[model samples]
Target chain A: MIILNQSKLNPSNIQPSEITSREVFENRRHFLKAAGFGLAAGSALLLSRQSQAAIAPVTFKANSRQKISGFSKTAYGAGEKLTQYEDVTTYNNYYEFGTGKSDPAIQATLFKPRPWTISIEGQVKKAKTISIEDLLKLAPLEERIYRMRCVEAWSMVIPWVGLPLASLVKWAEPTGNAKYVEFISESDPQSMPGVRSPILDWPYTEGLRMDEATNPLTLLAVGLYGEYLPNQNGAPVRLVTPWKYGFKGGKAIVKIRFVDKMPLTTWYKAGPSEYGFYANVNPNVDHPRWTQSSEKPIGAGLFGGRIKTKMFNGYSEQVAHMYTGMDLNRNF
Target chain B: MKKQHIVFVKAAIWLFALLPLSRLIWLGVNDNLGANPIEFIEHSTGTWALVFLLITLSMTPIRLLTGQVWQIQLRRVLGLFMFFYACLHIITYVWLDFVFMWDELLIDVAKHPRILVGFAAFLLAIPLAATSNSYMIKRLKTNWKKLHQTVYLIAILAVVHFWMLVKKDLTEPIYYAVMLIVLLGIRVYFKYQPHLKSKVTKAM
Candidate 1:
């Protein structure tokens, strides 16, 4: 057994993040912690909400999911964990599965995703393809509750399990030429039914600038709700960049290319006029098709104007600095 | 037109037209619309617009095959309903989708060349709907035919707008495309190639 010592744990902090969109969001616990609530006591709420999971949450292969959490078991209560378990799993946004939400839930099982391989190539010094099993074995699964912001202006918080991209990057000795990382989804049409569609070319691809890829917020998520990620959530592996819109974080990642330039993403290529490349979850920048300032919270909430979307999806502390001097509006 | 034919057509047309208007009111009142209610409403109204257009296009074919000229009068009513639904569709897209998001909306309008096509189609139909009455038809005399001929182009654009928005599995838009093709084809064959016309014109 590979014992992970505290000193060996490379906790890369986002000290450089400028927090430009800092006005809208504040961590509930950070506020509560400042108000003198014990961190240990607050974490007990995670187990408390196990009963609140769902009337019938999907029972996957037991603990196929690893838990490499840095936090204590009692240190739970990240924002609404069950926000979209029912809706998200059933009604997903996996284009590989298909356009409609139910489409992915029904079709993704065709792919034998378990024994998958993620090709890690391009600008990195250690450019080697890593098997999914090896990747999971290298790091323990850590449950992190995160708010997923979709470009459609909807929000959901799920207890995601996986290691940080920062952790993985450290292991893969970088030569420092990698300015951006591009993720390419598998192009198996028989398995990925959406590949049959002429929507935006087959084998969906999304990318992140170098700084964004290394950011602490960028996660290589594997599971959710302490269970193996459902087929709809890109079983095996998916990227979870919390602050950016959902589309920016790719699913079923097959390749990680370290490039000198930013790769053209799927949504941006589909309609460059409508979808910008740096699709950050910025409320200020309105989509050519709709507004982004406010969002509809999935599950139970008021019909009209329930929650206002925050800039960087409340991840300004972790990712804001990546956009240093560039005009977000112009790039948007 | 026969006395009974006029009354029957007018009453039936009015009753059918009221369904869309009432459904619109119910949607607005109950807030049955989704997160982006504007898109849902736009899609719904736009669908009805195409439905009305198909109904309007079918009128001439119905009269020709059945040897019933009374069907021609219902064409105006269906055409007007098409314009009505189109107006709502455009209104929802402009007002809510835009949220009066004027600057972005203006940019979107300027950027998408297709929006201009859609706008032009809607604008042309306005005059046709405005001059749909017997009074305007009587006044315009020869020009009425010229003004209403624009609907063929309008139908094409509405289909284009639909095709542009839909992600894939284009069965619905393709169906509309096919329907429009059949309609325009019928008009062409009847006018230019009379030899292609079937001698036995049986009505469904």
Candidate 2:
């Protein structure tokens, strides 16, 4: 065990420049106490302009209405490297644009995500359709560092900017009967090529239990890495339930419905056996096709070592009570 | 065919087969291998394995139709390349993916049907690759022909492995499946049409 720890400490295994740089090294030391050394280095590396440019998100003409705010940051998944913006955008699982990881970035380049409208309806006391500008003005946006784990056994630490879904839910004034919230992404096949194929049922749908939707941790993210959200990263606005797998956070959302019962989700509807409705990040509950026991951190590059996946993506303390008295294995 | 042409074709096949590997090396060295490099390597090697298998599978039909007996001899080299890539794909998983965790790897293999099928395909290819040499071919004689036929099954298993791994958007895997079906279909059609085969052989 001592030898193993010593070997891991050796910087040769990782990039020499990262270990040798004074700023990165100092940041690692200061942040390592709070966050894992790897996660600290990963976040610090993301701030470097070179990596930022390399993983550049989709560029939209900056909208004046989108106000950017910096907050006292708290690290989630400390020691985990933030997935490069390039990979996060380019290596997307946005089936609406296409299936290939790189497809959405390319296909979504021409997609107009601005001037969007989202309708708040269903069991809510107030039903209103609002423009993207109106939605942006609804609340103050703050950055939350989250560990976004994909169902495919790959994970990333993303610094997301958005307001809590709870704030939006309260504004909508959900009725007492409201038990679930369903979100629908833009479904134009004329622009989104992947929607042309039956790979998934079109008009991608995702839902959250009302409590899960309104949890303090549930975010309706509008930006990432201090910039407006990239189109492929679900521009304008999208849900970010950090404890669940990334898919549960529906992208390019156009509709928000508060319902009395569970809603049909795209992946769950397509392959019920492979994708569960909850889609919580449970390491013990393996997908039918792959194991969830471990995940390859994005931006760790090809040769980087794997890390054991944490329960609820290491957010169990904040969200575990929600699943009390329930069996994840059966529900999963 | 002229000796020059045979040498040129051999060299071209070698170059074409090594292109994917060379590109991978370049990407790895340059740090251009995106977010999940292991996945990039695994997918690249796995794609090349299918490519080589498809090329090797196409060779028999090409030889039967064109009567290019020289191309028939190249099948062994192509088959070996396929086996080499399959080995790389498995190595990437065992070494890089699971990092020699025998227990985890074992459990994964048992649980994931795609991994099991992929492993079976690799295992089946080993004997055929091992016996690709002239000595084994000469020693085994008719048995060699029977054993070598396992390539068809291996190819099918390989495609199935890809098909299962992809959740939806079967476009990529379906392409391989169609190509393999057509290649296999040609053989079955030619076998039943012995008279037409003789005419084609005469023309060649």
Candidate 3:
């Protein structure tokens, strides 16, 4: 059992250096404002001039991400080089924003992750809606650096700060009838441009079996890189199951329903033949569109090529027992 | 068109056709190719190749509509540009993405329909690009037209390769598919409606 150190975790005691300098932050805002004016004046010139700038490496210093304090570091992904905070935040697959990898960073600027409430219902002993502020205080957050493998064959090592889902499950007090847990993400059409499109059904949903939810490796991520999550990286609260593909970590989640039966996840519903309910990181089971035997690390650069993928993304020791006697290829 | 005018136009085409490659190099040098540089390069080159393929296919249509013969002369350069970008795209995939891992590549080609179709499209473009020279065209004579006609097949395969690769949003691929269909459809319409063809010829 972990003991809470209230003083060490105080938000006000956060080191100033951990936060972006005010000058740089202000400059970035000014640059963005200038770019907006350029867009209004002559978009053609802006397009030609900023073509390369559009793909420039994003710096965390540009945005003043709130510093998350008091979380203790865990040995998750020890010795692994963490992917740059810029790449992890900028390159995302939050389909609610847009399909392009960089789209989330550009489009999610207006997304408001605060004042968010997750409704916990279904087979739980008592259904309740908890605000994001209340949820953060439920348990002591820990920074767990984990290998995040995407279904698209790219991977990242992210330092996620959050409490275990088991803690939340214990708090929810699920009844015996609860067999599965479904996560539903926010689908505000006004802020989320991708939701306006008919891509994969809005309010993206993902799920986990009852035991999987209670697993120690499953994290309810609220922050990354020692700061509150950037909007593009699923601000407020999101799920992070290190053993599964990154898609299993639903972003901007607003609902946690404990149900008796399996939930039809958004991706599974979109392409039943491609995505399966048990999206465990199985290297042997290739996605229908591409090979899953290898994955390119996000910050590996051009020549980094790809490294061989591992079973359960190298976390088989912890999560493989959950799938004992079951064929991963079928349940993949 | 006069000889000088045609030369000037050809030079402009050369400059315009090489812009995508130049832009890619500039981005690479500036380190602005985003988080996944290899994927960015692969996508940029592949999209340019498709754009050039569609442009090459449109030359005859442009001539048919405007009753101008000058645009037809640009087809060879346009087609070659398509092959050039396609080569870069494949090289990026093989050397950078796969790192010449022949065994994995073989498995990828065999297992994935998207890779197979894209590879087949590249292979088909080889013969067309090879026989594009004047000497080879003169030597092949009547058979040259038949060989070059396979460009239509290459375009179809390229479009299908893109369509298959996209995860869900088919908007971009659908645009390319529609463009290819319209280009091919124009020829089909002209073939079926000889009266319209004669009228176009009379106008020319």
Candidate 4:
């Protein structure tokens, strides 16, 4: 519920009184000190609050994020506690800007997400480019809180504001031959520094099967936290397949191609053995580098231990039928 | 170097080595550890461990190049500091990251080669750190030198652990690998120099 304006909370605004005493600030040192005095009770709550206050200044900058209006709330993730707006905006994995988690927030200041156009190509009724302004008007926007899980074993619960991707798919009127949908993100070397490096293929790409693309749970998010999507959070629009890993959400999309053949996604091409095409959040199938059985929830204080990862990231009731017979272990 | 000068230099190295830990505390107090504080701490401690390990490896080469015995004298403290940071890095992973979830931790170590390699490197460093003091060094004598030579393997495993963890962009890991290669390469070249010299003299 806290609305933080990143620009307003400059580091210079820090007052000496706001900071906890040094002995109490360092949790381990404080714990030792408290244990020495036999007053170890109630320290955990105090430390968690202090840590929360530490990152309290990290929300979207007022000048950058425009308030989105007239979106209806949905029953999605109704009972879940929403991740702090500051954490959602500040912690990101937009590689176009940079690879580091905090890189996107700092490096995406110059990225212009407005006046954007998405070129719909291949197997559609007619290939056409639509402006972001036109795309925003296609359907009634709804705010859906969804749990977004990253393949790196971290997750955040975000209230995304946008229409279901199925609306766009229906509007596009794909031909019978269209069996897959591919999303290609913008990659301007001038604006996106990470594009210059050969980390993954330029113009980051992701795709979903025809059925998955049309699923109700799949969203085309234009904004989050009741504001226009921050430039770092893909800006104008991006895909949100809650059942899959966060990488499946292609940001700053410039192209959407409906193709007969399965498209090779960026992560899949980068490391075929590790990243798979489906990328469904399955706890049993572990990533080659790390375990997928558990994920650390972001905004959970330093002491907040990891939670057990769920099948389909806990959206199996809606999405499990799509992959009923598919061997996820081999596909993963 | 005078005995007092050596003592002063050791104190300075210890202070410099503690700076990374001090920096982490400063950042923690300021709430400047970024969005993922645990990750920041893990990376900081892990990177410092590798840096100290590389510095420890460089001592023999420095002595070889500059013929300075003082460089060798600094190696133990530098090596111990590497072990110290390595301990903190592993503790962060086990205590903070997993919170003593032994089942998950065991499965991760078993399933992921990256975690296993890093764990192995820490295990090897244990004895080296244990026998670093004067009493153990005198008691073990020649065997101590043989046992400590495993540092070469530990260094290699540490670099490989880093190399495997990165998804793409091997630039950082490659830099560490190159440093390890150069440091270890110096020893190999020097070890064979006498043999090579004899062969050249016979041919002449």
Candidate 5:
């Protein structure tokens, strides 16, 4: 099967010998150049762990929760580690790190997440800055394999390791006016290079409705692929709302502000027509640019047929009551 | 019009045109086009068609600017090829994107801004390609000139369609815009200056 993928990618024999010697054969040269690149890329995956480390040694382990019980190992590099698919993770949105997936791994590798602190400010009664270590110290960990749907029309099944967001919020103690929980990553043009691109303002911001944050479905993940988080996967800590689009989960978080009204989200700040604050993974409500009814799974590549996106990304049983009266089409 | 010369020219241009189209087809076949493969293919083919269309549009201006009168002969061939790629572009979207699902297709046409501009450009090209013959020239001798005026509108939409498609890094769009401005500018100069038009036409 592996050899089959390589067999068709032969670029050396792309043009006949006659064509290469033609007076106008710019394309033959271009094909020769492209074929070289394709072969190098195809070989990179077969390298041993130690060999791959020479390039970028980010050792990975399985989600710690997989060690616990009946949760069968998953496809999200579970019970294993992850390698960079510069094309996939880098280009798509895994919003916990910011909307751009590639931007986070590239920009976030510089963010010093270790020995980091998260400040719980705004309407929270016990507002204080706490070390991430102390925050992790407060809760017991579990692994949950959740369906992640991006608003951009892609989905992934990831086994995330973290505790409920409720556990952290309860520790913070929300006050009466706190209707929204605004999760903000530290803004550093020096670190988060995406902010430097003028795509969105520095320090990504995502908001969850007060009840939504309290819901058991929301998780504060610190690990994926069964080990410490990769920088590209929003290392250290980030939200994991399995049912909502990936953007709803903020990454490399530094500020947790409890607010009264609905907080403005990053995509909404840039273009409200596409992303709604409540970015539920719904099939009926299409993005202004594309359909939300279907999504491509990672590694499925282009020719792979799309899977039908579910209501709330198939987590409706756990979260559907949150929007009992509101029209999903409108809220979406 | 030697048989062998015509055959070799056709083969060369045919091979030249196939490269870009083949990359897309290869990617589509290999499942590497990206998440929204249908959209990616649609946008890609559409963009290439616009590029080839713009390249076809540029021929006259380039000839005018460079004093290369012989460059004019390639215009009809390039124009016809533009339509060929444009057909594949739209067909790929209709077949793969909408999957020929009529109701869903209508909704997509209504919702997607990118699809609208591309669809409009495609509709305009049909007439342009159909009229590129001696029979149509003889039949609509007077109206043919007026009906073919739609290429100007198609060219502008072609550029706008590309500009709107880009999320950032305006370089590609700007490059197309420069070509478009030159193409349209030469037409405008020749159009208004009737005496200069004959001189410009004869010189080229």
Candidate 6:
């Protein structure tokens, strides 16, 4: 393990005001480059320990290889800055790679999401398997900045570019009997090591009520921040339900099934008492283990503080009419 | 035990104990604490606390198995480090996470069973950490042993606290729980070994 000598970390050299300045930090980056420790750029941002190996900074480029049209940047809700692409891609909770937040960022680099075929079956008029490329051809994509609130009470404002789920369901021509839409994620145990362990039932599944699926706010995201989805952030395709907790949005999905009954989601199946079916982002309804009243936005620093969590993640104005008569606390 | 050997062991323990804090400081200063730094700090400190507690608990069994009386000397260092990390964990949650809003914190403590259990575990660890010195052990005599027995309960509580905090994946907590159980099982086996041996002799 290469240890950067502590003597070289001169606090006086790095101006106190410039310590948090990203621009000034770039200067320090250049300085480290000149000093020949450029290789430790990522580790340099983190303090190096003698016992452990230095972690290489994860580097990924936004490859918007697919042409998406009719998608204008329509800003939505509270106008929080889109989380830094680096942070958004690196900081993930996709347990398919592993349970650790950073595990997906590192381990998912090798996952091949291309040549991916999704089987769209169940209660749809045209139940057939389709290639991801063919699905992309279904509708014009739109860039929607949606607030993704995790069940863990942290959140991110993500700039997602995708077609509306309503368009996909329209193409599938869902049967009148369809009450729910179930999503099954890709589960190759050889690639997705998390599948080797029963952290969750293998071939992760998540569901949305048919109306929720047809909601305009519900997006079948193909990219983020003008780039194709990073493997860690669910490459090729994923669901983005802006009004619900993040887990409701399954990643690396392989199957989209329109069903007659409320589908059993992976989390709700594992612990029904903890994770409810309609995992809506209701500040009034606290999770069994944690309060949902507030959320710390991702990329918020140590002193950068938390904000009051908005009901339905601030999309209540648009989607509140759907659950008019149901008790949110019970359904949550 | 040789004086020089004991000194070297003490130095090693101290250095090892300080590694997690040094790593945290490095991560904080470098601004490499990912998106949720408070959660990162809380988790890192909390994990280290359980790790140190497991290490400390293992010392008695190690001593019993190896017949190394000197193994007891390292227990204090590990126990103190466990308390130190637990303090950091609580401080981060209360100060940084909640900003010391005692009312909100209290309400949460009441509402969340995991938080309440974790708080109880931390509170129970206080007397054991406070009485971890040779002078206190000498003065308290048998009371010290009785008081320190709370460490086992604290270990169980810490594991449960972790198990409850996790959303779905119980793999990590399950691993910690198994480690704690094995460590305690070693002690129980040793405690009853002589009785089992005598019973075998009578049967023969």
Any runs in candidate 4 off by more than 4 Å, and if so which?
A1-61, B195-204
> Model 4 over residues A1-332: C-alpha lDDT tens digits?
11111111322223223544544556665565758644544555555645533433334456877888889999999999989887888788887876666657756777889789999999999999989988888999999999999999999999999998898888888999999999999999998878998888988999999999999999999999999998889988999999999999999989999999999999999889989999999999999889999999987877888999999999999999998888889987
Our model 5 lands, by Cα RMSD against the true structure, at 9.1
DockQ of each: 0.04, 0.20, 0.34, 0.25, 0.21, 0.25
Per residue, candidate 5 scores C-alpha lDDT tens digits across B1-204 of 366765676678778877777877777676555435565566566766776787677777766666566555566677788888789877876665545666666776778887688789889989889999989979999898788778778888878877776544454577778778878999788778888767766875
Candidate 2, which segments miss by more than 4 Å at Cα? A1-80, B200-204
Which pairs in model 3 have colliding backbones?
A: A9-A70
TM-score of each: 0.69, 0.86, 0.90, 0.87, 0.75, 0.84
Q: Report the C-alpha lDDT of model 6 over A135-226, residue by residue, as the tens digit.
A: 88888877988889998889998889888889888888888889999999999888777788888887889999998999988999999888
lDDT of 4 by residue, B65-131 (tens): 5556666789999999999999999999999899999999999998899999999999999999999
Interface RMSD of each: 16.8, 12.5, 14.4, 9.1, 9.4, 6.8
- By TM-score, who's the top model here? 3
In order, the Cα lDDT scores of the candidates are 0.69, 0.80, 0.85, 0.85, 0.68, 0.81
lDDT of 1 by residue, A234-332 (tens): 887899888888887778888988788888888887878767888888888876655577665665432333466788888787778878898999887
For model 5 chain A, give the 10-residue run with minimal summed lDDT: A1-10
**CA RMSD per model (angstroms):** 16.3, 12.5, 8.8, 11.3, 9.1, 8.2
Positional deviation of A227 in candidate 2, in angstroms? 0.8
Q: Residue by residue across A1-332, what tens digits does model 2's lDDT show?
A: 11111122321112212223445545545775588777867776554533322232333335622446653344544565677766676677888877767557656756778789999999978798878877777777677889889999988889888888898888889899999999999988877877888888879999999889988999998888877887778887899998999999999999999999899999999989989899999989888878898888888765676789999999899999999999898887
What does candidate 3's lDDT look like per residue over A1-332, in tens digits?
A: 01111112221112222234545545655666677875645654544333322322234434558898799988887898999987888788888877778667766777888789999999998999888888888899999999999999999999999999998898889999999999999999998888998988878999999999999999999999999998889988999998898999998989999999999999999999998998999889888878999988988888999999999999989998999999888999
lDDT of 1 by residue, B123-167 (tens): 888888889898998999999998888888889988887776554
Count clashes in each candidate, considering only residues at least 3 apart in sequence or on different chains.
8, 6, 1, 0, 6, 1
Q: TM-score for model 3? A: 0.90
Candidate 6: stretches off by over 4 Å: A1-57, A61-70, B195-204
Off by over 4 Å in 3: A1-63
Worst lDDT 10-window in candidate 2 chain A: A1-10
